[model samples]
Target: MNRNQHIWLSVFFSLALGLLLWKLKLPNLFIYSLPMYPTAILPDFIEPALDPNHRKFFHSKRMFKFLVICLVILLLLASFKSQHYFFWFFGVLGYLLHLIAESLTFKGLPN
Candidate 1:
């Protein structure tokens, strides 16, 4: 799918998640879901222009792991410094949506 498709799909997914998690602490996944629409295309620009494995780098498991680490680090740092939970949670959800959107293209993290 293209950028527009990814954006619409991510928006839909985020809507569902937001409703499902409405009672939870982070109910506003939709607020931060915008990041996924653009970030989902990062791999295409960063990877070789004509490379077949274009989505490998940004959508791969390593990238997901790195995002997890970043999230953890952010949470840990939040203990010491003031952090806006809304954006942080939105960013985390957006990152996951980026991965999920890629998977929809049948590019489920490099083998």
Candidate 2:
């Protein structure tokens, strides 16, 4: 997807996530979820849309898995009550959403 599409999707998903966070009584709701937008477009920034096959290292399935692992690790660390938990969590979450959005395309994601 294009940058605009990624941004809109991030906005929608971020708002949804924000609502969930609010319902769960999480603190600093906006600060946590707002990172989603930039992160959602981060892959494109790292691997620009220079060609039809621009998705590579930063946009691969392996990268998604890496993010998932990082998310899990962050959650574990967050359990210790780290103040930066939501920021990093939502950042990775946003990037994962970008890969997911790309995976829906005809090209799909690389290994």
Q: Give me the candidate number with maximum lDDT.
A: 2
Clashing pairs in 2: none
Q: Which stretches of candidate 1 lie over 4 Å from their true place?
A: 20-37, 40-52, 75-83
Candidate 1, residues 29-74, lDDT tens digits: the string is: 4555445455545555566336446666666888878887877776
- The TM-score values for the models, in the order shown, are 0.59, 0.90
* Model 1 residue 39 lDDT score: 55
What lDDT does candidate 2 reach at residue 25? 86
What are the per-model C-alpha RMSD values against the true structure?
3.8, 1.4
Error of 2 at 77 (Å): 0.9
- Model 1 residue 67 CA deviation (Å) reads 0.9
